[model samples]
Target: MDLKTASSLHRLRLVSAPEAVSFLLLLVCSVLKRTTEFNAVPVMGAIHGVLFVVYVLFWLDAWNRTRWSIGTAALYFLLSVLPLGGFYAERKLKAEAENAVIASRARAESAVKA
Candidate 1:
């Protein structure tokens, strides 16, 4: 794949797990707030918010470059909200990037032959 696609994918991959972790932390913070005196909400909330925005921006960039279908876009978007969704999205995105690389290589080989 081209550099732009590769970069966008890399960014998304890097952000995915952290985003998920932050989301899970946020959930835990919410529970802790209700059950105990713990108040990790502010810190975790800010972190999750930043990570979520980064995830969305990278996802949008990849979607625009990849020209993903509505279903695919929606799947990724929905997946971002779940506790483990980011991990799933990262896996799926990795597969997609691999496929893209293979396709790009095949096309290049065929063009060289022609």
Candidate 2:
């Protein structure tokens, strides 16, 4: 992968953790609102909303930059809707990105020697 691809993947990974946390908070707040008088819904909703938007934007960027397969794209998209999916996405993306970097380096090294 090139620098742009690497950068886009990095941004997606960076946003994933916060997005997952916000989603969890939203879930907890919703439960709290139903179970008790405490209302954290508004704050949590706003936070999750912002994170979701950021995640989508980064997702799109990475999708455009990296030539991912349909299954890979589907997995990333599916994770957005499921609770705690962001964490899974983050882990998968980090490994993929690392692999991409290593592959790119290997290719470059071989090209230089050939």
Leading candidate by TM-score? 2
Task: Summing lDDT over every window of 10 consecutive residues in candidate 2, give the lowest-scoring window.
Answer: 65-74
Candidate 2's C-alpha runs over 4 A off are none
- The list of candidate 1 runs beyond 4 A from truth reads none
How far off is model 2, as Cα RMSD?
0.9
- Tens-digit lDDT track for model 1 on 1-114? 798988888888889989999999999999999999999999999999999999999989988977889998999999999899999989988888888889999999999999
lDDT of 2 at 42: 97
Q: lDDT (CA) for every model shown?
A: 0.91, 0.90
The alpha-carbon RMSD values of the candidates against the true structure, listed in the order shown, are 1.1, 0.9
TM-score, cand. 1: 0.93
lDDT of 2 by residue, 13-107 (tens): 99988888989889999999999999999999998999899999988889888977888887897898788898999999899988998998999
Worst-scoring 10-residue span by lDDT in model 1: 5-14
- After best superposition, candidate 1 residue 54: deviation in angstroms? 1.0
TM-score of each: 0.93, 0.95
